[model samples]
Target: MDRAEVTELVLSAKRMKGLTWKDIHEKVSVSTSPIVVTAALLGQMRLEPNEAAKAAELFGLPEEAQILLTEIPYRGSLTEIPPTDPLIYRFYELVMVYGTTWKELIQEEFGDGIMSAIDFDMTMERQPDQKGDRVKLQMSGKFLSYKRY
Candidate 1:
């Protein structure tokens, strides 16, 4: 089956089993980070063979799907240009609003360079607030400075 088909199967099984991404991540014991493991299952990342096998067992996926999980996926291939989804759109909006500010601050602090998404780690937590529960996101990525040629 194609990656998209496998994704569909996985989503179907997850829904039928009433499983959360955390549930699958912990049960499969694939990665320490739930986000990474979830992304692998959602066809954005690759899992090692052993990890893929464990995920297959947890999700009741077939052999082909398990193999597909181990294959490298086309990351960010499914994103819409402007992001039609509200939650995703908010993230897009954040970048649009803060993109320059972030760039300027980073450049000033770290010189001319960029953050490496390939070598990144992120965490999401709920911050307790009397006004409302706030979403706290912490992202750490390696900084790659430009090389003088």
Candidate 2:
């Protein structure tokens, strides 16, 4: 399709009933910006086969969207989602704001090998704080040791 046609579809998808971009992002499990989503709609970038299927399930995309998964995308991601995606930035911000206690704690428990995010488990909890509120993230994964034993 042409540029205007593509953009109109994107905006329509963005507008579709009771749904919000934030909600779509959560369901889709990807760090997305307007630009990323738009490009994905316009076929400038691909969603990966699995991600395309998820997008279809989440956003209820059309059959045309299937081809988009194979398309090579333009550069996506504006800011990193943690420092990066503002939604997940709380933990990193906590590190900077609260201090390196988290770092030292990890080092003490884990020894040296870093935990693999790829093979990791993640949980987010909301707990009451003395001052107000907090977003707590708990992550656990097998330690991948550098020194072979």
Candidate 2 Cα outliers beyond 4 Å, as residue runs: 1-15, 20-51, 57-64, 67-89, 97-99, 125-136
Candidate 2 structure quality by residue, lDDT tens digits, 29-67: 465544345456555555667766776665555666555
Quote model 1's TM-score: 0.94
Worst 10 residues of 1 by lDDT: 23-32
Each candidate's number of clashing pairs is 0, 7
- Report the C-alpha lDDT of model 1 over 40-133, residue by residue, as the tens digit: 8888888889988988897788999999999989889645789999998899999999999999999999999999999999999999999999
How well does candidate 2 score on lDDT at residue 18?
A: 66
In model 1, residue pairs whose N, Cα or C atoms come closer than 3 Å (at least 3 residues apart or on different chains), thus clashing, are none
Candidate 2 CA-lDDT value = 0.59
Report the Cα lDDT for residue 15, model 2: 80
